[model samples]
Target: MQRALAASILIGAVCSVLSCYLVLKGWSLMGDAISHAVLPGIVLAAVLGLPFAVGAFAAGLACALLIGYLKENSRVKEDTVMGIVFSGMFGLGLVLFTKVETDQHLLHVLFGDMLGITPRDLIEVAIIAGGTLLIVLAKRRDLLLYCFDPQHARAIGLPLGVIHYGLLVLLALTIVASLKAVGIILVVAMLVAPGAIAYLLTDRFERMLVIAACVAIGASFFGTLISFHIDGATGPCIVLLQAFVFVLAFLFAPRRGVFALKRSNSHSAG
Candidate 1:
């Protein structure tokens, strides 16, 4: 239980930070694509006796780079290319899973085994999550400029390529960091929901980051506690809690919620 809480907090922190950028840049699908695309690497890593994270990072980075390349070179839309690449890689991973006999459980890989986390798993999560947090925070302003106005950023002599690929690399690493605790499938919510909730609640980017982190941490902690008591899946419980928060923010947020908008309309009419 201690280890689960620790892992959840770390996951919550790192994922929430990145989630803000993703929400701002409209890269939600990109997170999903990279998460699913890491499956083949995980399976192959097990077969080859390498750390699953190494293989997962490699595959995820490859997927992100490939998507960028195709988006640049082909006539196909970016979203369409992302859909194709992720689905194809996911399919390949599924095939490899069927062909390779490994000890790792498929359900665990897909949904996560948070309660099953070991001391080593906790350490791994700590290092990756810590490193990712530092890098993202350090580069926050540049990344924000790049996401908000790529053309203006380039005109100001920013290295758009570096910022672009750097963010993708960070995104891939984050998904890799989150692989064990939330697994491939549910990590998408970890990457998206908190920032979305924050977005609805605040207009300032800095405040957005803070609110998102708080939301994620709170949800992760309580979700883990709930799951422990109910004997439920940790990842799903965490995600569901984030969803619930989002729904509340959606209906009650001061400036952005449904009721808030309705009130504004009524006042304008008055």
Candidate 2:
């Protein structure tokens, strides 16, 4: 249980970092889609007795690439394309699940058991999380530029395709890394909530990332402890804790919080 909780903290920290970029770029739904889309990959991996993370990563990256390509070239809007892809992938995963006849495998992927996390899963999560952090840190400037202004990034000789695809890869890694603790259903919440709350509290991208990581890690730790004591599902509990933080941030964060805005308005009126 300690190991599982520690792994959840690590995963939360990593997700918080990447999610800063994801939320800023309006790619929150993309995170959701990838989470569900990876289901078939897990099912196939189970059938072939392969590493679940490998299968999930492969399937997720493929879907992400497909979504990007279609959005760039097709007449369909990006959100529409994402919707279609998410539905198709989820449907396929459901079909595969029905065929597999595994005991609780589908449920496990949907709502994970933190207490059941293995050392192998932890190692996989560590590799992906560490590698992603390294890459993101190395290319922080480019990613920020791309997020703020893709046209300017291209004008500045940035490899737009590379950065775009790299972000997707990072997102996939995050999803795969987090699968064991949070499952596909709640991983999106882990990815988006901390970052969203951080955005409300800070305008600086770097600060937002730091704040999000802290919030996510803290919530994961406390939630795991709470779940352990109460005998509840760890993932959902962590997510609910995050939601509580978001509500608090919304109500009390400096500058953007409702109270702050009200004070500012009163001062202006005076």
Candidate 3:
């Protein structure tokens, strides 16, 4: 239980930071795609007796780069490319899962085995999450500029290509680190929800980061507790908790919630 909580917390913290960039840059679909795209890599890694992290990172980065290339070189929109790439990869993973005959439990891979996390898994999560957190925090301001104003960021002598692909690489590495705690499916939620909730509540980027971190940490801790009491899956519980918080933020956030919008509109008319 302790190990699981620690893993989830680390995963949540890193994902929360990236989720801000994802929300600001409108890269939510990219997050979803990379999350789904790693499954086949995990399967193949198992078959080849290799570390899952290597294969997962490679597959995720490949999918992300392919999406970028296609979007740049073709007429199709990025969302369309993302959908196609992720669906194809996920389908391939499903097919490989049936044929590979690994000892790995597919259910755990699809969902997660949070309570089953070992000390070694916790250590990996800590190292990856620690490094990722530091990088994301160190580059937060620049990355925010890149997301909100690419032209301005370029004007200031930022290397657009490096920033773009660096974010993708960081994203892939984070997903690789998170697979064991949240699995492919729930990682998407972890990468999206907290920042979205924070966006609804705050206009400032730095405040958004703090709010997102708080939301993610709260959800992970409470979700783990909820899952333990109810005998439910921890990943789903965490996602559900985040989703619930998002709904609350959507309905009640001071500036942007539905009620606030309605009141503002009425006041303007008056």
Candidate 4:
């Protein structure tokens, strides 16, 4: 239980930070693609007697790079390319999964078993989350500029390729780190929901980051608690809480929410 709580906190924090960039950049599908694309890597790693993280990271990075390459080299659109690559890889993973004999449970890989997290798993999450947070915080300005305006970022002397690929690498790493806690299917929610909720609440990037982190951490902690009492899956509980929060922010955010907008309009009419 302690390890589960600890893992949730770390995963929540790291995921929320990247979630801001993902929301700003409109890369929700990209997050989904990478998350799904790691399955084959996980399967192969099991067969090869390698760590799941090593295989998952390699596959995720490959997926990102492949999407980029296909989008640039061919006439196919980015979203289409992402759909193709992820679906294909996911299909391949399912096929391989059936053929391979491994101790890993399919449900756990797909949905995560947060309560089953071991001490080693907790340590891995901490290292990945801590390292990812450091790098992202250090390059927040560059990443922000890139997300807001790639052309402007280039005009201002930023290395567009490095920033672009660096963000992808970070995204991949984040997903890899999150696998044991949230699994592939739900990790996208972790990567998206907190930033989206924060986006609705704030106009500033820094504030967005803070709000996102708070939302994620709070959800993770409370969701884990809820799951324990209710005999629920921790990952889904965390994601469900995030979804609930998103709806709240959507309706009640001071500036951007539906109710807030309606209030402003009424005041304007008066």
Best by TM-score: 1
Clashes of each: 0, 0, 0, 0
Residue-wise lDDT of candidate 1 within 1-270, one digit each (tens)?
Answer: 999999999999999999999999999999999999999999999998899899999999999999999999999999999999999999999999899997866667788988989999899999999999999999999999999999999999999999999999999889988888889999999999999999999999999999999999999999999999999999999999999999999999999999999999999999
CA-lDDT, candidates in order: 0.94, 0.90, 0.91, 0.94
lDDT for model 1, please.
0.94
Deviation in Å, model 3, residue 254 alpha carbon: 0.5
> In candidate 2, which residue ranges exceed 4 Å CA deviation?
102-104
Q: Kindly provide the TM-score of model 2 when superposed on the true structure, using C-alpha atoms.
A: 0.96
Question: Which residue pairs of candidate 3 clash?
Answer: none
Residue-by-residue lDDT tens digits, candidate 3, 1-270: 888878878888999999999999999999999999988998998888887888888899999999999999999988999999999999998899898887766667678778988888788778878898999999988999999999999999998999999999999999988888888888999999999999999999999999999999899988998999999989999999999999999999999999999999999999
Which portions of model 1 miss their true places by more than 4 Å?
A: none
lDDT of 2 by residue, 1-270 (tens): 878888888888889988888888999999999999999999998888888888899899989988988998989999999999988998999899888865546577889888888887778878888888788888888898999899999998999988988899999998998998889899999989998999999999989988999999999999999999999999999999999999999999999999999999999999
Residue pairs clashing, model 2: none
Q: Per lDDT, what order, best first?
A: 1, 4, 3, 2
* Local lDDT at 50 for model 4: 90
Question: How does candidate 2 score on lDDT?
Answer: 0.90
Q: Which stretches of model 3 miss by more than 4 angstroms?
A: none
Give the runs in model 4 whose Cα sits over 4 Å from its true position.
none
